[model samples]
Target: MTVVAADAAVSQVDAAAAAASTRPRCSTEDMLQLLQDYDCWVFDLDGTIWRGNEVIEGVLEALELLRKLGKKVLFMTNNSMKSRGSYLDKCLQVGLPAHVDDIYCSSYSAAAYLDSIGFDRSKKAYVVGERGIMQELAAVGIESFGGPDDNEKRASFSSEMLHDTQVGAVVCGVDPNLSYYKVQYASMCLLLNPGCLFIATNTDARGHFTPNLEWAGAGATVGAIKGVVERDPIVTGKPSPFLMQDIAAKHNVQPAKSIMVGDRLDTDILWGLNTGMATLLVMTGVTDEQLLVAQRGSSNGVKPHFVMDSFGDLRRVAQQALQQQK
Candidate 1:
């Protein structure tokens, strides 16, 4: 789908900052300078700009500033729990701005992966995740396995089904009702046939879903299955170079000029760094200051070229780079 940045993104910062101030530091002028060069930006939302119910301070201002500089902004998140429409509402609720074409979530990536790989959903495959994940499956023509046409049962997911020829693959993610029985069924299928593929939505460790933080993300569960099945599953999420390719294609932007921004080392930052794209690690979520600081010793320069306390300062780097050219 086409993703665009929101107009509210700029104005939404101050109020959010007042509500959340226990954050890092930034320089306004520096951010303004950085904005001069880069026209496109890919942002990670959760920790970099907001945490749960509260939006990060100055995030809206940062976004607005980017708009002022004529930069193209997009939100790229690895969490595939919520659908694009839900995310549209999410931006409105939090005061962030981006067009529907500017939002690229892991679900989009997963859907694109299925599309590129030519996954035929005519067969049966048990689902254990959120609606966003299922939506991606449907985009690829992957329907539920329990339909009358397939003669599959809703609870057909089982060790027996895994061993049976009818079962094709196992797709897992964050489902509150996930149970040992469900896992047993998924594992049974993978274990039954080493050729079956396993796919996961993301690898986020933890998210402030609500009143309290929750267990890390879809990674551990997929990892556990990999350990048991002794077969590697194909990861259909961020940092795979595939997502960037899809985004670039849709936006018609040059990957060489675009930059990816976020607060996590594993998902947001590394996704860009590993794929030969410029990345910025905003100290708003998952990886803290200490960890980001300690992580700087990489001799391979595999680390991000720049790090900022928040998205608010992104413009500074760009502005400064532009000045040097003058």
Candidate 2:
């Protein structure tokens, strides 16, 4: 699992590309060994587990096997469109054995981050996202407005619309109902209201909502706000080390004894690397082999320790391991 440093004479990009070419593929034996070695398994949801509404093939069985084997299994995602409860419902609907406690989405993380920062409970938050952000904020006793409610407001922008000077923070996420009004309101809050914090659940540029297409993600909305406000928002999701540090503290997760299974190198794999966990890249979500290979030269030396076609492939390894044990 160690990446040997390349020759100093080689260019940095060339050395990284060379190192990537030698990245390990998770063979059946390696998977089995991983099962034996790691006590905890952290999985990314969008790509590594399911795509859109469909569960990735055999992933349910693989998760069941992990639970049966007494491994700690957790699901993490940057998709801020849904709260952890909603995510748990989706998991149950798709026959994935998941508990509410095992789910960690950015919606929940955003709320947690606010609470950690001692955000004024009396102040209101303007949300340019969806019900998920609202739900999470409410759960933490923080008041919020301007989510789906503003979807109906199509009026031209004006200064009078920026009425809520009490808005202490503007939280942006993957807003399917994004509108000019929302962007203007969010921007005005940050610019007009003194010390009004700008927060982003995540900055993922694109998301794999369907098998054939990529859709604009939270980053698009964040970018729109940034354009108007000209200020960087605090990112609370993946690769930030905020949520990971919280997870480690609350869940007793020993990074060295855990493996992070994810699809995107920038977020999932990089987050694991930052937190000192082993990383496995799966190809069922946004990242494909071609993209993976292309990123080698541009990844700034970041590479996953192992690669696999799909997480469901682990079911086969688990089945084989169970048979051997029997």
Candidate 3:
């Protein structure tokens, strides 16, 4: 084939994808019927709720509809860079009525996991993330070292530097200020301490903001430590089931009666599958129809139970149900 022919073929594929995205997998009646089975709604924040600083269209209205229907709603995110309180603030800023109890983030889950294992003030954690990790750890009375402020401003470091043996755990997330010193110190703590714990918030290598844009995720920093220490860290975010464990114990979530709505198939859909809940994929944030089309016949990876053009359509479905009731 000629180069022009290849270009035309590529353009055709793009056009086909554009058309597929505007289509919905389930009818309004079917969606309402399916929603009746689930009492609790668990959502992913980034791609599912909002992208960057902009709230997705119809998300607030959809949430309102769910609330009016008496569904228990909770927000779950794998981005460990912010605390739950911070996330709650973002929700309110975006016109989503949210309570402090309604938000759950990977930082909170990581801290909760630490607290579950008898973590206390007596133990110390060396963290590679930002203030979010520190804030959560402090809430549980766990002391942490090597936060954003602890990072060295200068490149001066040597093996002669004193090592702190009190660090019983090394926790890592997305750290923009990640440096060789942070990696070296975390490696020292894990290497010197015979039973030191290594934990990660999420292993997502990259996050997709739009179909054509992407950004780094927590896995990048976590992988840096793994490269130096040659050991795998315990992941505490989606697909790990740690957050679901807490949600089940506290929120009384029944996996069969719950719905996990997200944009990323690997993290959100896979997480719901791992927890035995139905999953919904939305195209507002990441993972377009082209990718979903490829996974349609596969039995291996987690596939969403339903797919939609965007999260706002769920609100429209709910509105239709209300009209039917009227």
Which candidate comes out best when scored by lDDT?
Answer: 2
Instruction: Pick out the ten consecutive residues of candidate 2 with the lowest summed lDDT.
Output: 1-10
lDDT score, residue 90, model 1? 93
Encode model 2's per-residue lDDT on 1-326: one tens digit a residue. 11112122123444454466666458888999998888889999987788777777888899888887878999999999999999999988888877888888988888999999999999999999989999999999999999999998864634356459999999989988898888988888899899999999999988876644678899899999999988789988887778877778877889999999998888899889988999999867766554566666563756888887778889988887777767
State TM-scores per candidate: 0.78, 0.90, 0.89
RMSD of candidate 3 to the truth, in angstroms, is 4.9
Ranking by lDDT: 2, 3, 1
C-alpha lDDT values of all predictions? 0.63, 0.83, 0.80
- Quote the RMSD, in angstroms, for model 1: 8.0
**What is the lDDT for 192 in model 2?**
87
Task: Mark the regions of model 1 whose C-alpha exceeds 4 Å error after superposition.
Answer: 1-30, 145-164, 211-214, 298-302, 313-326
RMSD of each: 8.0, 6.3, 4.9
lDDT of candidate 1 over 91-136, digit per residue (tens) = 9888876677788777666666766877665555666566776666
- The whole-model C-alpha lDDT of candidate 3 against the native structure comes to 0.80
- Which regions in candidate 3 have their CA more than 4 angstroms from the true location? 1-24, 154-159, 208-213, 297-299
Give the alpha carbon lDDT tens digit for every residue of 212-309 in model 3: 35677888888899999999998888878878878888888899999999878888898999889988887666565567666764657557888776
Clashing pairs in 2: none
